[model samples]
Target: MKGRTTAWLRKKAKRGFRGYPIATVAFYGPTGDFATKVVASIFPDEGSDPAAMERWFTQDTDVRTDAEIGEQVIAFVRGHAALSIVVTDGIIGCPHEEGIDYPDGTSCPKCPNWAGRDRWTGERVH
Candidate 1:
C-alpha cells in the first residue's frame, strides 16, 4: 500500500499537488475523554474504489460524516477558553476523497457523492 501511495504521490505531483495534503482526526469517546491528534492521512490516490478504501479503514483514521469534527475534538481537549463552545473545525480538504471513476459501484471517498448523497448513510450531505 505504501509503495502504491508513493507512486500515486508522484502522479499527483504532475497534477500540481506538490506536497502532502494535511489530514487529522479527533475523537471524544462516550466516556468523554477528549483528545485530538494530527495524522498524515488522506493521500492523493488516483483510484478511490470502495474495495481499496475498505482496507484503508484499518490503516487510516476514518472521519465520521460530521461537519466540524476537528473543532469538536479541540473543544473536548481544551475545555474552556475565550472561544467557549463556539468550536469550529474543518478538514484540510473541504471536500475529501475525490477522483474515482466507477460505473457499477459507489465511490469510497468521505465527501458527498457527485449526486449529493451521503457516502455512508445515503442521506443528503448538504
Candidate 2:
C-alpha cells in the first residue's frame, strides 16, 4: 500500500469529510472490550478516480500500531456492512479537547459549565 500523506488528509478534514457512513468508530481490544473511539466522517470514492479514493482512505483510517487491531476494525465494518459506498478513507476523527463538547454523549446545554453560550467564543454553545 502506498503511504498516506498527512497534508492531504488535513486538507480533506478541514473540508469536513468525516468518516464513512458518518458515524463514530469505536475500537475494541483483543478481549472484545472497548479501547478508544474516533468520530471521523468517511468520504466515498470518486467514480473512476482511484487516486481520490486512496487519498480518502489514507485520511479517514486510523494508523494503528497494532496490525491486529486494525484488521479487527476492518472486519467489523465489513461484517456490519455499515458503508454508504466503497469507503476509501478521509478524516478519522477529531481529537478530544477540553471544553469542547462533541455532538455525541452529553449535550452542551446539560453540561454544568453551560452558560447558554460557548465559554471561548461567547456564541451559542448549541
Candidate of highest lDDT: 2
Write candidate 1's Cα lDDT for 75-110 as tens digits: 332332111111113222213223443333543343
> Residue-wise lDDT of candidate 2 within 83-123, one digit each (tens)?
43232332222233335644555533433333344433435
Where model 1 places Cα greater than 4 Å from the true spot, the runs are: 1-96, 99-106, 109-116, 119-121, 124-126
After superposition, which runs of candidate 2 have C-alpha atoms over 4 Å from their true positions?
Answer: 1-62, 83-93, 97-126
Superposition TM-score, candidate 1 onto the true structure: 0.17
| TM-score for predicted model 2 compared with the true structure | 0.25
